[model samples]
Target: MPQKDYVKTARPKPKAKPRASNARRGNARPTQGANRPWLLIIITALLLGSFGWFLWYLKQQPANPQQPPAEVSKSKPVVDDLPVKPVAEPYQYIKELENKEVQVEVDTTEREPQGPFQMQCGSFRQAEQAEAMRAQIAFAGFASAVRRTEGTNGIWYRVVLGPYDSKRQATADRNRLQQQNINGCRIWNWT
Candidate 1:
């Protein structure tokens, strides 16, 4: 094993050339999409200018020869199919009663006035339905009242039983209503 000398060798690295400036590169390739912002601005300006020109052109053009306003018929088209029925005049007694003042008897001793508990049989949006329910209550031999209440949605017709003198009476009325197979009867307080 003889001694061996190790020599250090140096390697040279290649130098990178300077990059072209954006301005020079822009001039070299005029159609290159490098300046996208400028292209977008130019396109937008053209669009806005055309729109403004269109509006100005419209203003310069003479107002379309004012055509005569369309004639609107004052009368409605009527279809005369059924014969007209005559309306009955009011009873003569009503006019006589309107001018007369009559005396009435007081009977407050029978019992305290009815309480506020009322039995609501049904609520309906349609007048016909409410009327039908009222008729049904009449047929059932019970006096019912229709209350028209306006709410956010629309008018509501509520068919309700009397505000009985006590809760017991109201409960009894509800039971009677249920026996007749009439469901959805709910008690409500007037207060």
Candidate 2:
């Protein structure tokens, strides 16, 4: 068996050199002048300078023009402004009776005074409700007690504050209780 020889090769062609253009090879094709950021910068600076000058000018101006002072009266008015008539007193007899006392005989049929002031903090048909209100009043720092009484209407449980003799003292206590958010409290004169 004979071996065959595979040898004869073809010659390769040379690559052509790329020709440079006159514009690219430093032939002074006017280079687009260094991108003009300076113009934008100068414009911005001028705008800022103008804005500062405007603010300075505004600050230099006066807020208002000068004005003359207001004239004031030197003397009081001559005519009286009040009405000529005097007010009538409501209870002149009570004022007159302040110092003097006159005694006269009267029947003893009138009921005797039981207490000073009778305060009804709550009036409820339900005894439990009245009792609850009484407890609430006591918790809120007022001396409260529940009392049941029968009347023509029906039986009612009343939360009583005090049997104060003086109405003024009772009124003061009522006001204090009211300030503490206690509602439906009233002073009564029970004989």
Candidate 3:
């Protein structure tokens, strides 16, 4: 069997056609005119329905009440036309306090010369007893001291309560010492 080869042939190109101008189509007026009847129908229906709704809403409202008096509606206040009130003096209240009698009592007893005071909790011949007293005083929240002094008999250790600022403070220390069952506490003057 023999095979045949196909030959390709070129045809002439198609001629360019001329297009019609839009001006010659007379501006397409008829199709636009056809839409007007339906558009008018829709607009008329909307207007009638809105008029019906407005009529219904008008019937739903309550009857109007009598109008308010003109004087109450005026923007300026009636108080502005009235006379002003007189104000009382600012310091008038102080005169009442000045009239009341106040009696002041002054202390007559001379205060002791300003020196730190001390309370003697115990006088012991033994240093250990004095140290023990000092420890007990410290545990009771007071700072105490042990002073060694030579007496007529021998050197003694004195457990002192405080170097307090005033006699009343020293008295309070003596009371505290009494609470601790050491009733022989004495107040002493110290510079």
Candidate 4:
């Protein structure tokens, strides 16, 4: 084969076609940063305008000087009524209540406790455990005592609350302990 000289012809570079969005918008195509400064300027102008309006509004308002708190006066209250209302008949309930003996007849009579009530918080074999429980109960604001009682099982230490005058009082104390998350307190008649 005869040697053939080959020429690498550089075809005209294809013109970069405009993007579809840019082509549709034409000259209105937004630049990466063109509106940034304008936005800042507009926002700044709005803020300044608002501040100026606030200053003008403040100037328009009548200045109310702060007055010292007035002492309660013993004078009759000033009424601003066109028609003088007949002085409201003086409150008669107070006078009637003073003379009236309100006999509140309690309909239900609760059965009273037979004797002084007591609350037994816990019975423990060890004195130390009983003392620790008593300390915890004391922390909750109740005075408790650890009494050592010899039972058929063995010597047991009882953590007792009180010789409460009433069952209601003993229940109240137990409820208070319950609020402190202490459970298993039994109310018994104190010997």
Candidate with the greatest TM-score versus the true structure: 4
**lDDT per prediction?**
0.83, 0.82, 0.82, 0.87
Give each prediction's root-mean-square deviation over alpha carbons: 26.7, 27.0, 30.3, 21.7
Q: What tens-digit string does per-residue lDDT give for candidate 1 at 14-42? A: 68999997687776655456657888899
- Name the weakest run of 10 consecutive residues (lDDT summed) in model 4: 4-13
lDDT of 1 at 145: 89
lDDT (0-100) at residue 145 of candidate 2? Answer: 83
Residue-level lDDT tens digits of model 3 in 1-191: 87654443255558899876656766645557666898889999999999999999999976664765456657766667667776876677689888988899999999767788888889999999999988888777788889999978999999887688898989987787678776788887886
Model 3 lDDT at residue 133 = 87
Candidate 3 overall Cα lDDT vs. reference? Answer: 0.82
TM-score of 3: 0.40
Give the alpha carbon lDDT tens digit for every residue of 1-191 in model 4.
98754543345657899667765767666886776898889999999999999999999976675865557667868657797678777688987988998778786988865898889999999999999999999999999999999989899999998898988999998999999988999999866
Clashes of 3: 0
- lDDT string for model 2 (48-151, tens) is 99999999999997776486554666685566789877687667888788988889989889876556778888889998898888888887788888888999
**Candidate number that wins on TM-score, 1 or 4:** 4
Model 2 stretches astray by more than 4 angstroms? 1-52, 55-115
